[model samples]
Target: MTMSDDIVRMARAWIGTPYQHQASVKGVACDCLGLIRGIWRERHGTEPETPPPYTADWGEGGGQEVLMTAALCHLMPIDRQTPMEPGEVLLFRMRPGAVAKHLGILSAAGQAPRFIHAYNAHGVIDSPLTTPWQSRIAARFHFP
Candidate 1:
């Protein structure tokens, strides 16, 4: 299977993990970044860089795209204007003009693209890429 497929599969394996700030563990707990970190660990063996402790509002308060910047530093950037693909990483802004701080892994593509993410109070879930979610996508990427 392709690396992207592996990443998608790994992400799916973490479905139902409780959402926990700064934590990363499949079937246990993880935040949005933690979910991505866990997938990276399973696919790449280690994180490119250790992330320092960060607040939930790390980038929003400063109006900085901290998550997108980190993604560009590690993953390969893709056209945000194009349709998504399986295994692609998405950066979400949550609200207009806000820093893109949320992340989700695309698990399906084509007719109905689905993304897997750890949502607050809901834990990990794979949801349809509805228009509401699509409109908030700030960037797209793939693990190198």
Candidate 2:
């Protein structure tokens, strides 16, 4: 299968994982970054590099594109202006003037695009990419 297909397959396996800070386990728990880490491990055999401990306001303080930089280093950057397809990884800015800190895997396209992501209060779940969510998207990438 294609790498994107593999990514989607692996992400789907994390569907029921409980959301937890700094956690990464399919049946147990994981956060947004954890979900990406898990998918990377499954596809690439090992994590490209270790991540340092980060706070809840990790990049918010400096408004740095920490996650975006890491994604460019490990993942293939894509055109954000173009329409997104299934299996693409999306980086989102939760709000204006805030660092982009959220991530999700696009799972469907066309009339109603859906994405799967792990949230703090709610575990991993797929939600439609409604208008509100679309406006927050900052970038998109694909697994290599």
lDDT of each candidate versus the true structure: 0.89, 0.87
Cα lDDT of candidate 1 equals 0.89
Q: What does candidate 1's lDDT look like per residue over 20-48, in tens digits?
A: 99899888899999999998888789999
lDDT of 2 by residue, 53-131 (tens): 8776657988888887898899888886777888999999999878888999998878998898998889898889998
Off by over 4 Å in 2: none
Q: Estimated TM-score per prediction?
A: 0.94, 0.94
Global Cα RMSD, each model: 1.2, 1.2
Name the candidate that leads on TM-score: 1
The residue pairs in collision within model 2 are none
Quote the lDDT for 82 in model 1: 70
